[model samples]
Target: MTMKWKGWALATGALAFSATAMAAPPSAEMISFACAGCHGTNGGSAGLTMPSLASQSKTAIVDAMKKFKSGERPSTVMGRLAKGYTDADFDAMATFFSKQKFHPTTQAVNAAKVKKGEALQEANCSRCHLEDGKEGKDDTPVMASQWLPYLQMQMDLYQSGARKMPEKMAEKVKPLSKEDLDALLHFYASVK
Candidate 1:
């Protein structure tokens, strides 16, 4: 009788656990499907002007979304779109994107600029961006293989004060001539 009772209790416990799990909210992958239209499947952007989200740190994605929601970050569409999501949704989407593989952008670059950009990246940006900008530390987004136009747009925003950047990054970027900026862009796009 004792053995039978133990088996029955185990089965009942398993059933209850399954019920609870089933009752939980939609998963991160499900929530992330909504982002595919603009961000591409699994956070890789196909659009030249849109920044890809794959492999970016979860903190980076969440922070950007939070800023968009709060109007702390300027955007043409993100600000409006961000208003609809709950914190849980933001977290879920971030988690989903952070785990996806980064698909590097394929585009033409000036070989001379690429060489100069590589040197510049090593000297100035590698501390946080690491791996030729293929890797990011903490909240830093990956720079390697990102779209040139998108990068250019972002740099322009940083220069114009339309977007905020970390003080150190701004300091490093502020002094660069336009040619230097172009070289940096070429270098980042060259990273595979």
Candidate 2:
């Protein structure tokens, strides 16, 4: 090839390489490390109040982060933390967390409450929160094997209107008494 043609070819090749590198998505592991401090390594939270993100649905993670970022979701720290991330950042982290396996935390729960909770879950929540609340559908988060305290906190938020609950969920939970709520928590905690 002529020298001038060869130079032009090299320049074009270099430009293409640079564009390819820039177009590549961000590293999921690198971006997700920011979550390890609170959500635990690979999103399996060790803290009782922090819900585990591992094995959560990607859509759920993205929606929650977006709400937190927009201040639509009430939170002490997540809102602040989420504000710093972009849609791409959220997608990367969500993809990483969604792929990790969820390991349930073991806790002692009242058997009686678990029974009532099971019945309540089947009657009211089964349609959406399938797999006995272990698996999530669409934007729903996994409820089974979640931290009991976290579950309680979220329920309290929904009940108090601090966090917006879905219309169906609100209708279902509206008639439930405090005791009934506690029973549901126990039932979720009991699920493996």
Candidate 3:
């Protein structure tokens, strides 16, 4: 090849390489790591209130992220975080979390709490959350495996009207006294 033609070919090849690199999507590990700052590595959070995302259903993750992005769901940090991602990004993150195994942790294991909470859950929250609090195999998120502090915080948000909740969920939450909420959190955490 002529020197001039060779130079042009090299330039073209370089450009193609760069473009190819740019076109590739971020690995699921990389994407999940970005969330690990708060969500913990592999979605197993050690924080008192952060929820574990590992092994959660994809639909649940996608829906929550979409709600945060659209401002339909009330959140402090999540809305801003969700706004930064596209639907496709959310899907990828959800899929990543869904594949990882959930590592459940707990602090309080009062039998009384578990017993009372079970009764309360059966009466009011069983429809969507299911009897196991795993949220069934549906679009709804899991509860039994969530952090107790986080669960309590979310419950408080609903009860105090600080955060918006689904109408049906809010209605069920309305009847829960402070004690009931505590017991419920305890029960769920123990099962996890």
Candidate 4:
């Protein structure tokens, strides 16, 4: 092809790429004022009931918001709040939080608890959560750096039917002893 023709084609491609990038949605900070009280500025929550959004998958975050807004996933607090969010707000929030790194905590974990948790995780949880519990695929959220209290609360919820989970997950965790549950929570929470 002629040099002039090639130059024109390159220029056209660059312009199209720039336009697409510029059209991409803004970050969560634009709409986070509504969520900051419970979810914190970076998606880490002080409340045990609130799950951290740092490093969470964008699709998962968006889906959860949809569920909350629809009343399919029941949350007294989130349901009411989510109802007020637009699709654009949800997308921007998800995109923003997904890009943030998790804040590491300095909480001390019991050595014995950590050891037992590691063993229990390897035996029962590793298949799904993998070695770090952060290497998730698809809908699974990263659990490696999750808060201990939140982990425990979720397990209890799953066991008691508070958190509606899939049949497979419910079935797998149905037989866990109290100690096993404690160990699993400790192991996951201790991971950096």
| Model 4, runs deviating above 4 Å | 1-27, 46-49
**lDDT (Cα, tens digit) per residue for candidate 4, span 22-83:** 44354567686557677776876666556778777787788888988988775678888888
* N/CA/C clash count, model 2: 0
Task: Choose 2 or 4, whichever is better by lDDT.
Answer: 2
Give candidate 2's error at residue 160 in angstroms. 1.1
Q: Model 3 Cα displacement at 192 (Å)? A: 2.4
TM-score of each: 0.86, 0.85, 0.80, 0.74
Q: Which stretches of candidate 2 lie over 4 Å from their true place?
A: 1-25
Stretches off by above 4 angstroms in model 1 are 1-24
lDDT of 3 at 96: 93
What C-alpha lDDT do the candidate models reach, one value each?
0.87, 0.88, 0.80, 0.73
Clash pairs of candidate 3?
none
| Alpha carbon RMSD to native, model 3 | 5.0
Clash number for candidate 1: 0
Clash list (residue pairs), candidate 1: none
User: How would you encode candidate 3's per-residue C-alpha lDDT over 1-192 as one tens digit per residue?
Assistant: 356855675777864655554444787776778998898888888898888888788998998898888887778899999988888889899999988876678575789988998988888888888756764356767787687778888877777777678788878877788899898888888776
